[model samples]
Target: MPKSNIMDTYGRFDVIFKKGIGCKLYDDKGTEYMDFVSGVAVNCLGHSNPAIIEAITDQVQNEIQISNYYWNDKAVKLSNRLTDLSDHEAVFFCNSGTEAIEGGLKVARKYGKIKGGNKKNIIIYMDNSFHGRTMGALSVTGQKKYQEDFEPLIGGTTNAKFNDIEDIKSKINEDVCGIIIEPIQGEGGVVCADSAYLKGVKALCEKYDALLIFDEVQCGVGRTGSLFAYKKFDVIPDVICMAKGLGAGFPIGAVMTNKRASVLTHGDHGSTFGGNPLACAVGCAVLDELVDNKILDKVDDKSDYMVSKLKKLKEKYNIIEEIKGMGFLLGLKLSIDVSEFSKRCFEHKLLLITAGKDVIRILPPLNIEKEDIDKFIIKLEEVIKTF
Candidate 1:
């Protein structure tokens, strides 16, 4: 390989994928590989999807993007569709997951000042949660490593233990403005929030006059067999930040706010290219495929099948310590080094993203069939047998 000009931010893999189809990818040399990472759970419908392609092609022929100053048809349609499905009444489109989280925070803080007599600016986040990497989003991200180098983060934030309601309650105060958490912690090893815990947090937020923000950037948009994971848990949040699968790899994100948290007046928050025509059109198409076409209808069944197979593997292989998460955003806790395991899987033409210390994430396309999962299991077995 020639000396690279790209920044060394990412620890990239050796193989450069040139093309991809459903649940599969092709390297520059045309070598086939099964994809379980799904662009870190972005390409929920799979790569080069017909609907997404058609939508983007048609959109480009007409218009791609315009300043948010003027309203656009596709953006309006997408906003309407999202609000209709979600509990929120308003939507703010952005470019990525981090931007969505940042926007949600701004909405929360703005609502707090207006509703809470402008006294509360403090926000609470949970341990092991990954909201995003941007400065505002990073402020709520619970991992210390990501925050170590970047000190003096957005102030008035506290980190509570995941699933520990008392820890959350202990940190809540009169000045608390918002509390953000992931319904399922994606970068934190696919940990799930306890249903009762989430309910308790909701009640506490209500009592404290704080906004509840659900960071569904990784687990939303049919990844967890629902439009959003919070909806599946049946716990309503004041603000919901979503991306990743929202555009099915088209690079779009959104922040939804309920009536109570809709305190941000005009000009409080804005994005130049947020709800651009092209991204919104792709978002609309993805929504259509997931909702109208009933692509997510079979997700629960598929997740069940995959989990059962993983359970069998756990019983047979002692290296398989545990299986965590729900639906397609699953993880395998391994006794062995997951980094090495993932590397070996990559060498074997199977892709897996490692999460946390020893968890291997099993994020496949939402529309992936059981047959593809079976193929994944077969490949996983081969990788383990030699390990």
Candidate 2:
């Protein structure tokens, strides 16, 4: 291994990946590894997808980026598609999930001011929720481990126990402005919000005239067998913060808002590199693949196939405690050390990620085939036997 001047933020693996194809990565030494991580759910169509490549190539030949002062046709097309697919009426494009969250927070606060003056500025987040790592988003993220180092975060933020409607009811008041939640908590162990719990929270937000913001960064964009996770939950939110799979690894984010939550005026918030031609082209391509090609229709059957196999694995190994999450955003709650388990899987040429302390997050590509899944099971079971 050779040393370089990269940031020490991530504890990186020793392997140097040179290239990737569908559901697989090739190292510098020409070794192949099944990529189950999918760049932590960003590569929905898998690595080096044709649609993404074509979108990039086409947009690059014309123009890669243009000033925000002028409207890009690609951005307008993507925004129109997104709004048509969901209940949202408007869209604010950004560069990443955290930026989307930050913009959504500002929108919520402004809406609160408009509705009930400055007193209604409190934003409620859920316990164990992972919104983002930026200042404003970090303040709303419920995990103290991510917040403690950056103390004195933005004010007017409170939290309630996840899946506990009573706790949330006690937490909400007249001063509450908005409530942000993940339909499926990704970094918090792939735990899902109960349907009834989400409905109850929506009722409370409606009663208090507070905007309901759904952070679907990880679970949306057909990862949950639906365009938006809120669709499956049967609870429509005032704002939806999206990113991850939106650009299919091309780096884009958006905040979709309804009429009430669209409070950002002319000079409220903006992104310099956001909604550029190249990124928006990729975003449009991803949506076309998911919607026009009927890619989302295949998700539910694949989920059933994968979960059944995982349950059988659970029956076979005592270390496998439970299966959590939905569709492609699944997790294996192991009684053994999850980090060690993940490391061993990596050693055997399988890439994966860990959530919380004990769960192994399984985020495969949306377009991955069943043969690859079967191969993953075989490799996973082989790794388990070593433990």
Candidate 3:
């Protein structure tokens, strides 16, 4: 075999995309694709959205960044909007979902140290939960594949089975300080925790004085037909970690916390480009569109339509085992290998991705058009025929 020029980190796809507009993307050869992946749920408003482009461009013309040493109007405004939308009393911005997770962990540990001393540093995480790739985030990421070589991971983290209250309760102890979970597990095959299960977790957290942290990095920012997925369950968390769609393609992440868990004093945690003006400007624009344009309500309608189509497809194709997730963040379990089905869909001009071994993850832009969805269904049907 010949050596490849590029580093082999990601499983490389052959197709090269040249440009994207709305829910469709064009390859270098001008072939078009119905993009259901949406950059793994990052491009919430679709590609090259006018509002996002205009906001980013205008901000660049004026100012792009300012150190935390000085005040930035856009950052302040974005923080205010985020805090106002949730029960959280404060917000800390960062560049990616992982950074936000890192910040959240720091806050949790700091709170433990301040209130319970250093002994109470243990944090509970779900078995299949994914926080991030960074050390602190990776430490709590319960998947072993990502942690295989990383020895001596941040200590004081334990894994409990998702949706099993007994398993979670068994793991909790006096040393535990927090319990972090994805309201809807995005990367772990789109498994949603039962509402009763979430409520039970909340009760456990309350009983043990453990902070509840919702990692809505993928299923948040109006992806689940609400500003945050926790809202759907009516369970407010002590700290909420969000990213992906918050900036609608621009790099931004935030940790939103209510007053009780807002224990970080000055100099406890900080980031260099955490709340830069440009990213916040884009974040505010995305939020305004989500709220003022009533985009949140549309998420449920579109999700229902997609689910209906998928159910019909499921009947026709025995390969499909189940459909899971809320609103637009859907997962399709397959009797066949998901990688094979995903490749078939991609070859048929429909972009898709695999979540776990046998799950087809569909994360189209929140504002995707109905026509494009219909076309995707047609293309998917064609792909399933060959599969």
List per-prediction Cα lDDT, in the order shown: 0.91, 0.94, 0.90
Error of 3 at 184 (Å): 1.1
Q: Assess the local accuracy of residue 354 in candidate 1 as a C-alpha lDDT between 0 and 100.
A: 95
lDDT by residue for model 1 (1-387), tens: 558999998988888889999999998899999999999999999999999999999999999988877899999999999999987898999989999999989987887787766678888998888887789988899889899899888887888999999998899987898999999998999999989999999999999889999999999999999988997888999999999999999999999999998877788888888999999999999999999999989899999999999999899889999999998999999999999999999999999999999899999999998888899999999998976
TM per model? 0.99, 0.99, 0.97
TM-score of 3: 0.97
Which one wins on lDDT?
Answer: 2
Candidate 3 residue lDDT tens string, 1-387? 246787877886787888999999998889988888988989999999999999998999998988898999999999998888888889999999999999889878887787679898999999888888999999989799998898779889999999999999899977789999999888888889888999999999888888999999999998888988899988989999999999898999999989989988789888888899999999999998898888887989988999999999999889889998988899999999888888888888899998877799999999887888898899989999996
Residue 182, model 3, lDDT: 90
Instruction: Quote the lDDT for 66 in model 2.
Output: 89
Candidate 2, position 279, lDDT: 95
The candidates, ranked best first by lDDT, are 2, 1, 3
What C-alpha lDDT does candidate 1 achieve relative to the native structure?
0.91
